[model samples]
Target: MRQGKVAEPVGAMVIPAQRGGVLFAVGGLNGELYVNGQALTGQWAEELRKHVPELSSDLDRLQAMRAEWLDSPPQDRTLALAGACTDRNCHTTH
Candidate 1:
């Protein structure tokens, strides 16, 4: 949850992280994206855009999703993802 690391209900999510992979930039969730700890500066961001051409559009979508998630009232599950399990692998009781 902090610094791109999910430290709860441990599983595969932590393995790559433990090995120094950038799982995700937490700031991206807030619209200000980053890679590792540094901001995705203009030059570097362009370099990344070459490989991920839709990055800009995806960020736009992310903002919209955020608005819905934060501004809307409670909603039902899109899929039966909730279940009583400590970890994801065992969370199949939909």
Candidate 2:
């Protein structure tokens, strides 16, 4: 495996809106979304959805939104989160 690449088929939950949005990683005391206590991002979550028909409808709707966002490139500089995010004077250690 290379640093910029991932070996596919990483197992994950393809949770839908029907389950009230992925009950397992619904956050805790610190308000961080995690799966089995590990931070799993959307790039990784896509691995879970690629093989399932579960989120197809969402994919359709989101694709349309993606197209619209692409049309307005400048205004859509960053992906928006549905949670609270405050800009602090501190640095984020990524």
Candidate 3:
């Protein structure tokens, strides 16, 4: 995986659903978060949290919902880590 470089993703998990929107977590290389090559700094998580907060006042219920989502089936999937892909467009996957 590119040695100790953190900018490149060492691994990735893709969960595809035919009837759902997209939610992605992009980890920066060298601690710099970017989207379409634009740096987001500390605003990404904060912005997302504000838009999609806990689903309920009960933490347990929220946890259950998260578990359910995680357990759901995926349409097409890919599990990748460092050096897993050798492509010019390795920066992203559709």
CA lDDT, candidate 1, residue 49: 45
Model 3: pairs clashing at backbone N, Cα or C within 3 Å: 7-29, 10-81, 10-82, 11-80, 11-81, 12-80
lDDT (tens digit, per residue) of candidate 3 on 3-87: 1223563223122223432223233333332322233333543443343343112222323332333455222222322222232
lDDT of each: 0.32, 0.32, 0.30
Candidate 2 lDDT, 12-88, residue by residue in tens: 22233442333122222232233323433555346435543454444443334334434552221222212112223
Model 1 lDDT tens row, 1-94 = 1234322211111112222322222223333334323344555445544544534443333334434434542233212113112233322222
lDDT of 1: 0.32
Ten residues in a row with the worst lDDT in model 1?
A: 9-18
Cα miss at 50, model 2 (Å)?
Answer: 5.2
- Cα deviation at 1, candidate 1, in Å, is 15
Q: Using TM-score, give the best candidate's number.
A: 2
Clashes of 3: 6
Query: For every model shown, what is its TM-score relative to the native structure?
Result: 0.29, 0.30, 0.27
What's the ranking of the predictions by TM-score, best on top? 2, 1, 3
Residue 40 lDDT in candidate 1: 44
Error of 3 at 73 (Å): 31
Superposed Cα deviation of residue 43, candidate 3 (Å) = 2.3
Q: Model 3 residue 70 lDDT?
A: 45
